[model samples]
Target: MAENSLEKDYLEEDTQHGRYLTFSLEEEVFGIEIKYVTEIIGMQSITKVPEVPPHIKGIINLRGKIIPVIDVRLQFGKEPVDYNDRTCIIVIDIDAVSVGLIVDNVEEVLNIDDEAISPPPSNKTGFENRFMKGIGKAGGKVQLLLDCERLLKSDEMEIVEELFEEK
Candidate 1:
């Protein structure tokens, strides 16, 4: 039984090894490891929370489970735009905590090999690339691959985790 479980785990890892779920934010595109994604939902009514950061849009009741949603544009310091038909919420699980990322629109999944990935630029120009894990080259285009663990800082994660515990 243990051997079978091990084999299944290996197979799952192999299939998701280089798979990425791409999404667009304005003109730039970003990718997240497909393994972390739980589901992609359309824009829904969000209940605003007070005293939270501006980037945090608020929480949503997803089938009785309250999920905190964050605006990717606001999180990246970009100007906010009205949510439209194209808006999507990508629900992801990081470190056992689930959070929803509000993005402009979700693109198709792509398989980017390790050889096609390049490290992010140095953080010497006062530019922030902390959320980026690497840059993926796919089909003649560059995709900024996000490190979901780093998407929310430790402090922020704690706060989000608390929300999960509260309910």
Candidate 2:
């Protein structure tokens, strides 16, 4: 019985450790769970799909698979900037749908404890608040933890579907 209790405690602690793939957008550091990440690719030529939202940069051919790209900065309502050498597209798979998110650069993977994550601020003053799941305190600063699933919700998918149907 004591051994079973110890095992349970270990499992609980293991679950508390959240791994995030950190990245930079503008000057702020942001993170998303590693589980959702597919791959990080350098900036590629995107074939513009017309009439989609401005944030939807377009689609890219990934080894014969066409994946839609969303400019992360633009989606967060930031001013548009030219893609430079440091630009990258982080492919993510959520709910069986694959999409690419354009970021300024890819940072690093970090393991954050549940205790270090705090709920988002009540006042959604900035771009960080709308998509952020929480503020993860690490490495002497807060890493904006993004709720990727929430950020790329079904509404976006429906828009894409409708666009394709029209085309």
Candidate 3:
């Protein structure tokens, strides 16, 4: 039974590898590793927290668990827009931390092979490459691959950790 369980876990990980959950933030599209995604939900009433960055929208009580949400558009330095029916919150778990990413809308799960990914452009171009894992080209389109672990700065991560502890 233990061997079976291990095999199952390995198979699941193998299947999820190289797959990405694609979402949009305006005209630009982004992709995050599918393995980190927990769930996708419609916009919910967010209880705002204080003293944090503006990009950190707030927290939402998700079936009893409180998850901090970040507005991807604001985080990427884009103008804020009204949330419509198409807006979605993508819940993801990174390094045991669960958080929600508010995006314009989710596109689809794409299987992008490693060969289809390329390194992001140099930061000298005034582009923030730290938040990006790579650039994925597939299906005749390009998607900015996000580095989930680097999405939050170190100090912001402390705030998120504290929020989880307090709630």
Model 1: lDDT equals: 0.93
Q: If the candidates were sorted by their lDDT against the true structure, best first, what order would they fall in?
A: 3, 1, 2
User: Whole-model Cα lDDT per candidate?
Assistant: 0.93, 0.86, 0.95
Best candidate per lDDT, number? 3
List model 2 lDDT by residue over 1-167, tens digit each.
99999999998767625989999989999999888899999999999998888998888989987788999999888889999999999999867667899999999989888899999987756544667789998878889999988876577877654544534
Q: What TM-score number comes out for model 3?
A: 0.92
Candidate order by TM-score, decreasing, is 1, 3, 2
Clashes in candidate 1: how many? 0
Any idea how many clashes model 3 has? 0
Candidate 3 residue 167 C-alpha distance from true site, Å: 8.0
> Which lDDT tens digits does candidate 1 get at residues 1-167?
99999999999778988999999999999999999999999998999987788998889999998999999999999999999999999999998878999999999999999999999988987779999999999988999999999999888887787776744
Task: Give the deviation of candidate 1 from the true structure as CA RMSD.
Answer: 1.8
Q: Model 2 shows how many backbone clashes?
A: 0
Give the higher-TM-score candidate: 2 or 3.
Answer: 3
**Tens digit per residue, CA lDDT, model 3, 120-153:** 9998899868999999999899999999999988
Q: Who wins the TM-score comparison? A: 1
Q: 1 or 3: which has the higher lDDT?
A: 3
Which pairs clash (backbone N, Cα, C closer than 3 Å) in model 3?
A: none
